[model samples]
Target chain A: MTRILAVGRYSDVDAAALAAMGAQALPSAAALAALPAALRAEVHGVAFMGHESFGAAEMDLLPALRVIANFGVGYDNIDVGAATARKVLVTNTPEVLSDDVADLAVGMLIAQSRGFEAGIASVRSGDWQRRGPLPLARRVTGRRVGILGLGRIGREIADRLAGFRCQIHYCARTPRQTPGWTRHGDPLSLARAVDDLVVAVVGGEETRGLVSAEVIAALGPDGVLVNIARGSVVDEPALIAALEQGRLRGAALDVFWNEPAVDPRLAALPNLLPLPHVGSATVESRAAMGELQRRNLSAVLAGQAAVTPINAP
Target chain B: MTRILAVGRYSDVDAAALAAMGAQALPSAAALAALPAALRAEVHGVAFMGHESFGAAEMDLLPALRVIANFGVGYDNIDVGAATARKVLVTNTPEVLSDDVADLAVGMLIAQSRGFEAGIASVRSGDWQRRGPLPLARRVTGRRVGILGLGRIGREIADRLAGFRCQIHYCARTPRQTPGWTRHGDPLSLARAVDDLVVAVVGGEETRGLVSAEVIAALGPDGVLVNIARGSVVDEPALIAALEQGRLRGAALDVFWNEPAVDPRLAALPNLLPLPHVGSATVESRAAMGELQRRNLSAVLAGQAAVTPINAP
Candidate 1:
């Protein structure tokens, strides 16, 4: 019997791993719902990936679902409240991808400040030869940097920035022991205190629109914003307005409100260094995520505790 | 009488600075040579910028030229040997731009590994909406990184890479107090020992073609090459061929052989991330470099020691 259902687009390595575990593959959640009710009853576990909403409605469809193992660290798409209500264990692969995410966050920050988008374009368009150097970009080293949330991934970003001689300031709900880093009371204070703000908080309702208009204003016109966190954390409309009006210096984003479908206005901004949500989308990281996800699924389905459970349901 | 001549393209800030010092601005080295011998003999110092050759012939024209204050760290363009022989002091702005150069070096390394060129293109071309996430990029953190020179700039690059958790290896002619960093005897061994090689050696006759074909071959297909040092340091023809045949993974270059006119073949490579020699081109760094250059000129013309002299006469 096919006890596990692997959903969303996966790498060949991940697909092979799933196949070896006798897991049935589905393109998406909608596809899984289209299956006959009798067929859905046999799925005891799910190894999920992607940004599609996996809510109570989807959870109810899999009556025998014992666990949902998310492929990546951020599990905002998976409603943990719904999973808990349904008595389904929720697990996420974390720590494994912190380095890759942090690496990209730092990369985006430097790319935006250094005018890499324009620099790369100038070189490729043969403008460097004809037009000379791009306008002088801002210096990255020794700048004041603020992390929105100093979680595992945020700390990693801060740690990397520290090497560049950047002054690290952060805000977190429950403060961790961060020596040599200044901790702020809230997002607004954090934004006001730094030259650049990097959003590294969690996703979901609590954090939705956490980086509000006030926060953006506090960051000021000379401040750059880097969002490797969920798009929901930032008020996208305010960000767009600020960027359009030059009220913000620039932005380097890896995620968006409607990702894979970014706003054309945001996409057209000359100062932006936009990337597809590729924070943890590295060959090594994805493989580790897949392995962790499989382990969680296998453990939960065998009547043992999930390896990295988010909810003890 | 104007005792100083400022050459090459300078920022508005630098131009203002030179003007305040009663320095006459000429366009290039050729322009300086073309000046009337009477006027040229009035110039005691040259605040030089750009990549033009300043050899014995040019030195002979300015009988009163006591100091050549190069406006950047590398004085390769200025013939230091010629200056030494002529009893003309050669001073360069060394430490001022190390952070900027190191920042760009690290940025290029991450951008190349994380496919920032393709990723940026995907976002701009609306390919994310049309297609999907780009193929997973290689992870940057924890990779083995080799520095070809452990000079001030090389040390800065290694220090930044250290925060990324990279295993740092380096090859330096004179070993410094590098505690955790593994040292190699030469470039070939350094390239062979690491997954990525960054060329940070000085540029001139001795160090030209330091990253030779054999060195590139040793780095192999999975290794990346990042050159922020100089165009002359790497063998361009060999590098172009290796990139063409997939003998190396990729290269991120700031300087190129015969730059401002890069080889069309090298520029067209999908795996290459090319820049217009912007290692120390940040506004802050450039201002600092210009100020340093002026100080050197001012001191030397005032019958004092050059502030940061490369060749004392």
Candidate 2:
């Protein structure tokens, strides 16, 4: 039987299902760390959760490995260069997560702008019994939305926000004509022109520090910052400075710099709303991503190019 | 000059505007409390905030007082009986707040369903260093939505949800045929049939105890509740019980039993998301309501029926 080492922590697919397709599924993280030398030498492929970086030691074991299927859409954790040098194929579940992340960003904006969370907290705290005047709502409709890296996900966010009547603008590496969106040359320029700036770009060396303090400072206090992309894209220190100084009205983020161990400085600020990075956490979207990954794995093992391969690797 | 005891706080249309119309404005809350007997006898009308309940003492202000303009769509706060007994014309701002409230409810539904608050909290806390799995969203497009009442605001809520392609059912005093939405005979039947219940019933004695524990239990866990109507319409204790026990998946409430004091039970619960009643908090909506009240006050003082008279009180 063709053996496959699936390294991810969370997978919706059954092992028996993978076996049915003429492959063995090995997903225990502990097992991946302690594979017998003999067995490790025989493993022909590796699959893992879309969470983090795959180290060199694990890569050294799959001498005959030809394909790597990431469980989630992002592949920053995987060493694409090592895979490329070894002629390995890499695939990720893309568009499957677009709508869910878009949905999340839109929801965050609504909750923050309307003061829904704080209002809820106030009521829950018993401070609302006296029926004081209603705290105001920040107008969301007709506000300008500036998107960084208007790729597939960015475009989807734009499409969803279109329903709310916001004008859309985007900053990208190059200009492209999207029906309702106007294009700005890059991040700082885009931030200057809009009421809200959303970061939906990818994570990698090229994008590591793209959204620095300069960009955030340019966005200013009246501007709302939303990051649904990666923490690496933003300079955490700059974001904290902007938030502490009240240079930004509010921030809604789905990812953070040094996450899980989140910057403690950010944890203390009330202006920023944090989430435990669940952009594609919806039941429908996760299932769809898993199914898509499975299809890619099956196709690649069957000697076909993956349905959605990371072009660089 | 026409003497008018303007009981409500004025917007941009200040004393100057009223002065131009041959009316002198009283600016004190205490002045409102101690109306001069002679001035009270001379006043031809009164204008008030939506929050004020004109009690018997205030109602006995003037025999010449022909009209009262309420600065909100809801006249529930106004003691219409007292006004009616004195043959005073009472006009309320309506229709203006309908779309705004409906929009807010939908926004709340989307926020809670998508875990926007959680996402924001994660971002704010700096725990979002890496993108984690997102909670998959329940299919909002086709879920069953049960409305508590078939009044104007409820009807407007139905109108917006229609575009999402969901099945609509509502509980009302009597059944009425609208182009869309199926009317249920009562709350229990509607709760039993639908997946999401939206509260939009009127306030006060008749509908105060409407949504009981039994009705909420019938909705079941995974069933969501959204209340944009008066807080009394929902049995707060019952609803909180449902939320705590996981009998209901989530709830989005704007109104509370007490105005400024949020219920401690609700604030403590994570499943229930409360909003300080921002229904009709939009600038556009508020401005429109004010304009309508101004027009009504003008027309009534000119010896014409106000645009919207609630039982001539």
Candidate 3:
């Protein structure tokens, strides 16, 4: 009888680690659903990964489930409220991946501002020598940077940008005790103050469409938008429209509303730099995340509280 | 009479600035050479730009030439030693472009390590959703970064990497007083000490091929290389071979040995992230460089000492 189920297609290293802990592994939710009811009932703890939804119906199938330990920081896919209502504990891996996510956010801002797309293309098309120098790129240093939601990841992003000598401005519900950083009352005011706006707010209903059309417009034509947070934080349709019309200068995005399925229209725009949700995808960060997730599972399975618990049980 | 001749194609802003100073502009070296003897003799101060060779032969064409004020930092193309011997003062715009070059170097290192080439391609090819997830990229923070030459731009790169919490190691002639940074005796030693090597040495015979095959090998298969210096600083054939064979993990190069005409073999390699020589290519830096060059030309024409003289007359 299996006491733990590792759900998701993990790396070989992670898979081997889970196997050593005596957990049975399934590639996806579909695979878990196909398992016999007797085997499903045996699962008391789940090591969940991936962006697939895990709702009340799925939780009902595993009646003996006591805890769900997410492999990443975000638990948007899991119904944490339902899990709490069912007396099932939930935990998420955070802090371990903050640095990596912030690093990527800073990198994307610099790359987009410096025109890596045109620069690389010029070399590939044999146009550098043929057409003289490509047009000059905009400078990245000393610009005003606005971070929406100054949480752990947002603070990390702001810290990195400080090294570039950028003026840091941010928007959140309440002002934190951060020295030398300007705090705005709302997203629009933050956008107006900065040359570039990076979204680092958490996902889910509260933050859905937080960066409205007015905020995007306030950033202006010379402004840039970078999103390392979930795509739901911004108005995706408004963003696509702004980019298409050249109302906004450029945008570098790592997440989207219906990701793994980026809109072809957004992809075709030259100013939009699309990255397929690769924040926290580095080897070091992923390994740390996996370890944290395992530790949370071990604690719960050993008849103790989860270390990084997301809900009250 | 054209007392000041604006050399090479310049941006409209720069061109207008030159015209406001009552300077006559020529499109290229060839165009200047084709001018009548009287017109060539009238030119005394040259606002020189571009990478075309401007040596004794070009100097001989303008016998009355008093100064050659280069628009960019590197004066390798101007033959400064020749200018000194001929008693024709030379000035290059330095310090102005260092920040831009350093910014690009850091950006390239992060982009290459993050698998940006594949990430951008997936979006463009509409394979993001189809190809579940891109491979895990190596982490950028907390890695050892080796700088081949710790000059002005190298120091800037090191300073930026320090913010990322990287271990900074550098190779230079006779160590300077740098605290909390490792000093390597040679290029090979520097490569051995770090996970990534960024070339920032100046160009010319003394430093050509400074990053030899031995140095590249010392960096090993897990290592990366970034070049913002002149193409001559690195051995192109050796670099291409190492990257193609996977002897070196990857390389992000902004300069090439024969730029504007990159080797097709190097262009075809997937691991190589090629960028046209754009080290100092930004509106802010270029404007500053252009202003400095014009200042050098204006001072020399008024029988005053040039501000940033590169060669003693």
Q: Which stretch of 10 consecutive residues in model 1 chain A shows the poorest summed lDDT?
A: A116-125
- In model 1, residue pairs whose N, Cα or C atoms come closer than 3 Å (at least 3 residues apart or on different chains), thus clashing, are none
Ranking by lDDT: 1, 3, 2
Compared with the true structure, what per-residue lDDT tens digits does model 3 show for residues A1-313?
5488999989999999989988899888767778999988998999999988887888988999999999999888899988988889999999998988888998899889889988888888888768978778888888999999999999998988888889999999998988689999989899999999999999988899988999999998999999999988999999999998989999999999888888888889889888988899999999999999999999988887788999987
Q: RMSD, model 1, all Cα superposed?
A: 1.0
Chain A TM-score values for every predicted structure, listed in order:
0.98, 0.92, 0.97
* DockQ class, candidate 3: medium
Measured on C-alpha atoms, candidate 1 has an lDDT of 0.92
Query: In model 2, where do residues sit more than 4 Å from their true spots?
Result: A11-34, A55-58, A130-135, A149-152, A171-179, A212-218, B6-34, B50-52, B55-57, B81-85, B95-100, B116-142, B147-193, B201-215, B261-263, B282-313
* Model 1 ranges off by over 4 Å: none
lDDT (10s digit) by residue, model 3, range B1-313: 5488889889999999998888788888777678889978988888998888888888888889999999988877788877877789999998988888988999999999998878988877878888678889988988999988888899888888888888999999979778679998989889999999999988888889989999999999999999999999899999999998999999999989988889988888888888998888898999999899999988988889899998888
- Reference-based lDDT, residue A28, model 3: 85
Each model's lDDT comes to: 0.92, 0.75, 0.89
The 10 consecutive residues of candidate 3 chain A with the worst lDDT sum are A127-136
The TM-score ranking, best first, is: 1, 3, 2
In terms of TM-score, which candidate is stronger, 1 or 2? 1
